[model samples]
Target: MLAIGLEGSANKLGVGIIQHPDRSSLEHNKSVTIISNIRHTFHAPPGEGFLPKDTAKHHRTWVALLVAQAMEEAGVTVDDIACICYTKGPGMGAPLTSVAIAARTLATLWGKELVGVNHCVGHIEMGRAITKADNPVVLYVSGGNTQVIAYASQRYRIFGEALDIAVGNCLDRFARTLNIPNDPAPGYNIEQMAKKGRHLVELPYTVKGMDCSFAGILSSIDLHAERLHKDGKRWTDPETQQPITREDLCFSLQETVYAMLVEITERAMAHVGSQQVLIVGGVGSNERLQEMMGHMARDRGGSVFATDERFCIDNGIMIAHAGLLAYKTGFTTKLSDSTVTQRFRTDEVFIKWRD
Candidate 1:
């Protein structure tokens, strides 16, 4: 079976095709193959996250081109596709709507079934398939989400998340505050800085049970910048050295926030008694995070699995793979049920098929 997956929930427009063998012996709930995955990101302004309307415009203009290219890369035709899937939100509405419309139009034209999959599920499923870490605690940190999850009753359940801003947003804002180059993602720039910096400035660390709050940490950094400006200390000038540098701040921020995630995920693992840990989403690309998780897992005699950019970060292949599973289980949403939502809980999804 060939399936096309559409992911336009944020700044990315991903189109992926997956081919699955017909095996009646295999359970419907089993994860399957990924044929070819392709993704195209829309242009966003520096010092800002994705804007809903602007992203929507990019989707409408560029989705067809991207999907066509993906199809070409996969060496498949539209007629060969058995089903199409699209991200049905917990994301910005405009981009979600754009992808939804594209998927709907294509499904109608081809007379194929359309599956609406959750954005977070796509992330975790992609990570799981690539790593083969079943029943592992998941730390899914990205631009729009910071969540700790575990599989339960055939669905993934989020045990902890940010009450305010996501960890990625906090990092991006901090990168912007320092006038850091925002191209190629702020996290990349911050990671470079953390490697260079020696000083470690203490930052606020807050974790209430499984939930975290980043707004206070962001405000603290802003206040620190104001103090530096008032003291007439310029990082650019070598003579006027400040007690804290942007590099140190970036390092501290990463250390503090990621520690919180590790603690909460560890707690979830204890609760679930799962030995495997999987880190998904864009921030999972950070080597520091992977190292930290690896160390923690080693301490517990458990293994931590993380995806490379090919699967760890957002891509079309994961979405297509997830959509195929959902389709195999006869799990689908009607066109009317594909409404965009900003905050859909992960545990709210009911898994229909169990092996």
Candidate 2:
């Protein structure tokens, strides 16, 4: 069977086609294949973030072209698709609504069923499928979400999460403070800068038991940057008495925030008695974050599983993979029920396909 998925939960608008083999042809529990995955992001200028209205307009403008290109690349006609899948919630409301409307129109135009997928669940399922990490502790970190999740009693239980802004959001806003380019992505540019850093600046580290907070950390970093920019007071290492650069600040922020994420993920692993860890979402693609998670997982005699940018960042393929799982379990979203939301919790979706 085949599925066409649409994803526009944020700045990126994606269209993907996926194929699922029949039960007889499936092997080793691996049966899903990505036919094509195409995406275009709405890039905002430096020191600015993408607004929902503009992002929605971008999605509305490119969704059709993307879908057409995806289908052409996949060499599949609409008649070959079993369902049309789309992200339903936990994202910017305008972008989500725009994508949902496109999905509804496609479903009606092609006479196919519609599957509404949870944005977070799509990441988890895609991570599990690509890494083959069965029942691993999941750390989902993206622009809008930071969560430590695990499967228990047919639910992806949220063990820990951000109390305020997400880790990626913190990083993106910090990049804005430095007037870093948003092309490709703000986080990617920050990571590149952090690689060149040698000093680690002290910042607020707020972790309340399992959950972590980034709003205070972001504020502290922004204040420091402002002071450095306005006063021209050289930020120097207190011990080395050496000047600190913006790269150092980016490095320090990544280290501090990623450490909090690793700490909470470790706690969740201990709570669930699972050593295996699977990192998902856009922030999960950071090499530094992955290395830290690897260290933590190895300490527990386990391992870390993560995907490349193709699956890590927001894409339609994850939605197709996750939605197909739900569709096989007799799930469908009616036209009337295809509403979008900005706060869909991960645990709200019942994992009917998992044991």
Candidate 3:
């Protein structure tokens, strides 16, 4: 069966097609195959964040073209597709609507069912499919959410999450302070700059129980950036009494934030009594965080599973895979109830596809 997925919950617009093997052909638990995955991002200028209005406009402009391209690449006719999938919630209101409208239109025009997928669940299912990380603790860190989740009783139960401000949001704002370009991504540029840094300046580390906080840390770091800004980017390191470089601040922020994530992820693993860890979402692609998570998992005689940028960031293939999983079990979103939302919780979804 073929599923076409649309995802435009943020600055990026993506469309993909995935094929599910016939039940009799399935082997070794593998289920879905990516037929095509194409994406386009609306990049804000340097030192700026993308606004919802502009992002939604970008999506509306590109959604049709991306769908066409995805279809061409997948080599499938409308008749070959069994369903249409789209991200329905837990994202920017306007962007989510833009994509959902496209999904609804296509499903109506093609006479196919519509599968509305939870954004977080899309990431989890994609991670599981790619890494085969069965029943691992999930560390889902993205621009909007920071959550440690575990599957139980047909639900992805949240064990921990950010109290305020996601880790990726913190990084993006910090990149703005340094006027980093958002072409590839502000976070990606920051990660690159962080590699050149030698000093790890002190920053507030907030971890309470299983949940963590990044708002306070962002404020404190912003102040440090302000000080440097006033001095024309010439500030001294407080701990070493040496010149503070942009790279130093980038390095410091990543270390502090990633350490907190690793800590909470470890706690979740222990709480769930799981030895496997799976990292998902855009921020989960960070190499340093992956390394830190690897060290933590290894020390506990476990391992960390992570995907490259293809699966790490927001994309439609994940939506298709997840949506298809549900669609196979007779799940379909009614057209009248296909409206998008900005605050859908991950735990709300009932995982009927998993045993």
User: Which candidate tops TM-score?
Assistant: 3
Model 1 alpha-carbon drift over 4 Å, by segment: 23-31, 227-242, 353-355
Cα shift from native, residue 286, model 3 (Å):
0.6
lDDT of 1 by residue, 174-195 (tens): 7777767666777888998898
Error of 2 at 48 (Å): 0.5
TM-score of 3: 0.98
**TM-score list, all predictions:** 0.92, 0.97, 0.98
The C-alpha RMSD in Å for every predicted model, in order, reads 2.9, 1.6, 1.3
Between which residue pairs do clashes occur in model 3? none
Tell me the spans in candidate 3 whose CA falls farther than 4 Å from its real position. 23-29
Extract clashing residue pairs from model 2. Answer: none
Quantify all predictions' global Cα lDDT against the true fold. Answer: 0.80, 0.92, 0.91
Superposition error at 184 for model 1 (Å):
1.3
User: For model 1, where is the 10-residue window of minimal lDDT?
Assistant: 22-31
Backbone clashes in model 1, listed as residue pairs: none
Q: Count the backbone clashes (under 3 Å) in each candidate.
A: 0, 0, 0
Error of 2 at 232 (Å): 4.6
